[model samples]
Target: MKNLIAATYAPMHTDGSLNTDKIKDYSQFLTKNNVSGVFMNGSTGDFTSLTIDERKAITLAWSENKSKDLYLIDHVGDPSLKVAKELAQYASDKVDAIAAIAPFYFRLNSIDKLIDYCKEIAICAPNLPFYYYHIPVLSGAQLNMASFLEQAKDNIPNLAGIKFTNNDLIDYGHCKSKANSKYNILFGYDELFINSLPLGATGWVGSTYNHLAPLYYKIKELFENGNMEAAADLQSKAIKFVELLNSKGGFNGVGKGFMRVLGVDCGPSRFPHTTLSDSDYIEIKEALDGIGLKSWFSK
Candidate 1:
């Protein structure tokens, strides 16, 4: 799962039903843009808003749509151990890998508990590589991830690495520097991608990649070419893009809707995630075009 892995949106009908049918075009759109994989049903996929059946349907759709050009990393986390386990088992045969965040409802108070929780889920898919979805801001389990790398390294047999989604550079740096550099610490904060490049981050999984893979790939190219100034400038524009959509309603809703501007209509977001009017998208299109990010989308 190196390079860009888009944490994709759950395509839905306006009536809030899962539109799993869209995964084929979605997969092709991603591959066309050079995104290497899909991080299915993660935060950006609005997993929390979906029912277990719905999430499973989403997983099955992605699994069925699997291609040589795109890998699938299914996020199987759920507050219910049974549900998480079930999803993990379901993904075992379907996806290239599986991932789970700490159960967020009650919260795991200790790293030991997190390891136990992850281990249980991970064992269900022993054949598939597992990644701990470490997005503490959303999960509320802010245990030191460096310690997770140290502790979990030996515990979870299928553990491949961390889908690191926080802003703590110190901890991130420590995780990347883990002895032998075993894990695939997939940096998830899209805006901070350029910053992670210097630390040797190769794989990145995030929502914005669904919309701006070309832009980010270019950013990586610029950074790799020693053009720090241009990379930083593009990175700033990405932040601006998120902030701009965020101001309209919320970024997840607006940004997912922004996919239409990129030529793939992911349809409306689920409940609690505001859906925008067509006019809103028009205004967003104008705003993004004004900022010179129009060329980043797939034509």
Candidate 2:
């Protein structure tokens, strides 16, 4: 709720089990590092690969270890409305807000259906702030800003804002144009933080922020102080780091590899998600070392 600069979770285990201790450790690590918030059980967290119990365990662990200063955004996004509702209920008191993706896999061609789906989830967690996640590319739901705004105004009260992850800046700009000034628009793409901040985005939410929070904090401070050139330079470095990670297979492998390199020991990603090659690990180590972030690799 308080200007969220959040990190999405990296699934902590390869067996598709919730590593509660690791989650607690990671949550505390984020808290200590000054991250404003966290989005648990999200795309980077491999929510689809996890069982309901695993998701619940991760949420509960985070809740238990979470500092009052750290905001928790529980991503209760499952294809099943019932499971999502139940998870939301379970997380109601623990997290600051609850968010969900539009039901995916099945094509809901109409905006009406999408609105209805969101409304239903809203109904389930009336007390918690509900952020609608708009990642159309992965979810296969094209959310038109106009229609969503119109529907949300009429139907939902707890609908606080959106976590817009689309790569298209035009789509983000459109949403900003239509969205009320009070609504919090969180940019899910880490690389767009500097660009998005000027466009009325309240904060950022991304996997990279989990390990690179210090850099983001510095970048945000620079941007806020009107040092665009310095901010851009830092953002460029961050983007280059992310691009390097992506080249090794994006979040699944590289994200976990980053945690491992940082001595977090998060273990491997679930299968179907490839592990980092030995060469990939070496490349990552070299990148971290070049940045003088070698301390992260030391256990």
Best by TM-score: 1
Per-residue C-alpha lDDT of model 1 across residues 224-263, encoded as one tens digit per residue: 8999999898898899899999999898999889888787
Q: Each candidate: what lDDT?
A: 0.90, 0.76
TM-score for all models, in order of appearance: 0.98, 0.89
Clashes of each: 0, 0
Model 2 regions lying over 4 Å from their true place: 2-4, 10-16, 277-282, 291-299
Query: Could you tell me how far off, in angstroms, the CA of residue 251 lies in candidate 1 after the best superposition?
Result: 0.8
What TM-score would you give candidate 2 relative to the actual structure?
0.89
The number of residue pairs in model 1 that clash at the backbone is 0
- Cα deviation in Å at residue 268, candidate 1? 1.1
